[model samples]
Target: MVGGIAQDDARENRLIDLFNLHQAADRVRHGTDAILKLDNVEYEFELKSATTNKGGISTVRDLGPGHIAKWRGKHWIMAFFEGSKLLYCRYGSPDAMRPWITEKWDYIKADFEMAKYVPAHITLDTMFEIVGKKEVYTKADARKIHKNQMSAAQYETAQDTVEGYSPARMLDIFKDRARYVIERGSTLNNPHIPSKYFESWPEIRTNHAAKLRELVSTWRDAKP
Candidate 1:
């Protein structure tokens, strides 16, 4: 019993050390050392009681990563870690993460609460279809956009040699537009997104950006 206790303590200490190292590295990478703090790290290493299946006649095992199990009449499970919090969204496979982050960040931000504006029946497959229709801009597109913006500088110089626009300034503007297009197109093409949630995309993105940044910062600062 004493040996078993010592082994468990050693494992716990190792995990803590690993988290500390991750937190330290994040601080340097994101320049969030000032605002981020490393707090106690806790994780659920086992599947929750509610997730398990046991019956008098038969016993079906709980699902692990990449494994499928039936839950609440649904066959699929989508799981991901938000900081140290392990979240499970039902009725979807693991591939749902991309669509979830791209199309449903606002919904997830509210802890999956069904509010007046939020859609209650939007399935993960629907989100995946929405994400699929949207074009993901490639590096080639970026280069083409940059080239067109730079060409405008030549036209400006010919029209007014003395007051010509700066190439760098034009490039900055074009880059911003490109980013906006990439961000906006995803949501704009999805007609099912609620107007209220769509309008709040900027706020949602900002909050998530900060949360992710802090999460990384803390993880890197961890001392494993």
Candidate 2:
């Protein structure tokens, strides 16, 4: 069942079907892709597929989802793939994933300005008009505009969902969303607690392999 797949996304869907995981009813935008139940308890999970060229390294596009999930005090699964080829998945409480997430967050944040920003999505003509130029908007002018745009875009587009997922936009929205989640999830009596915790990465990986093997063999033989 996994001989050759066209795309990583297709392989993700196939993995879901193979495992009989209940897909999320709607897009958990900037969140995990689907749900998995083990022992009558459901777990939300994000599926990721990275190219095999990096010696089996997968990547996360945005730390937003992981941050939001952790702030909400939810334990989740993270599955990895190289096309149709499955890889080890992590199943842990947020407490367990926190150190890694923090490390990654720090790494990504190293390039961040942590300042105000204003985004201008205007045409070159408008830009030239603003600069009061009749003709070419030279490279020098563009450089000035770029600097202004990068610093101000965050403030202007914090809640702008329709904004494109540029790095600036993502930083703006994710920071805002993560902040809100943290405040909403906290209380005087109730503190962050992760349930359904499992820390054995090896066990999760082994189970997935065996389950997929049996599933693929049975599904292929049963195919018309």
Candidate 3:
């Protein structure tokens, strides 16, 4: 949701080109990266990148509450990766995803009250529950990942911008987190996820391999 073309821009841009989708002109916080015209309807998708090695946690860590609020009801297209190798991409609407995750907002508000703002995120364990962790990471058919390394100029602008900021203080800023939970998906709940949602998916939840086969069944016909 960052406005500028950051390190992940390379990956986002490539996806737009590869899919024959138009790139959004003005990239901003809580904004989309690509556009599509299907059946005379305009569709805007918020693209996200997750490293397979990192438990599908987003490469971009700036998904705050407001950003997420703006993201609701929009289509999500996430590309998985291992190092610089791009894996499969997945698409789903909010309705299709609602059952899989639970949102926690109370602790998020408390954190802000204490002068610390935690980022918000959707629970992805449901994705793992529907498919499996291995299915998302292990299979790379042919395509390699597109790397989007940030330019030096943006780094310079962001560096030590805080007043009276010392190198040590800057290091601390990177290390610090709120006393309350910062991970919205990881908060404690009466009924835990993956477990609660597990019983619902009888077809592929237990047989994770079926999830991969299922993707092939509905595979889209296109060229890279």
Candidate 4:
């Protein structure tokens, strides 16, 4: 059920089978009496660029069938499991369905993205543990992260989550602060806000209102 593919993707290329596909077919046919035989199935293949010196890798996956759903302005695939047993799967956007693999498939010939689900147990698990061990942000670090102009990711994350202040409220606060900076374009007003907020606030050019509108709009619509 599970295998891998290597070598260039061309019809002339030969595949050295590490696992037996025919055997799996025989077992499923004889053992299940055709009940388990796949009538209509859908497969998704992915290709990804490798970061390593080697050109890249490929991956393949099979998802029997699934229904589609939409979330957050994008479509997603959804699959349901009955009490942890394997059910069926459907595909949508990343927001929707989670992917799974069958045991009989060959993975070596798969495209990079498809193969990504193949676990690199050592490296990936080590990295997972390493991430948890990293230092948590100090108060100063948190301030530093937010001090500059708000990044798109941060803005988007804030918008999607319920724990944070509402977007409208945050927008009002940012506009108020920006307006204050624009009005008091002199050194005397600089002392009021923390220096970290801006690299010594830029002098208010003639287009203060236009500039504020542009900046607010940019932050509002950005993706996380």
In model 1, the Cα lDDT at residue 207 comes to: 36
Instruction: Please provide, for model 3 over 189-215, each residue's C-alpha lDDT reduced to its tens digit, 9 standing for 90 to 100.
Output: 332222232223222222222442343
- The reply for model 3, stretches above 4 Å from the true place, is 1-6, 59-63, 99-102, 106-224
* Model 1 regions more than 4 Å off: 1-103, 106-162, 188-190, 193-224
State how far residue 205 of model 1 sits from its true place (Å).
37
Can you write out model 1's per-residue Cα lDDT over 15-70, one digit (the tens) per residue? 32322322234433212111223345321121111111211111122211111112
Considering every candidate listed, which one attains the maximal lDDT? Answer: 2
TM-score of each: 0.17, 0.41, 0.43, 0.14
Ranking by lDDT: 2, 3, 1, 4
Global lDDT scores for all candidate models: 0.30, 0.45, 0.44, 0.26
Candidate 2 residue pairs in backbone clash: 116-151, 117-151, 117-152, 117-153, 118-152, 118-153, 119-153
Q: Could you tell which candidate, 1 or 3, scores higher by TM-score?
A: 3
lDDT of 1 at 180: 40
Candidate 1's TM-score reads 0.17
lDDT of 2: 0.45
RMSD of each: 21.5, 14.3, 18.9, 29.9
Q: Considering every candidate listed, which one attains the maximal TM-score?
A: 3
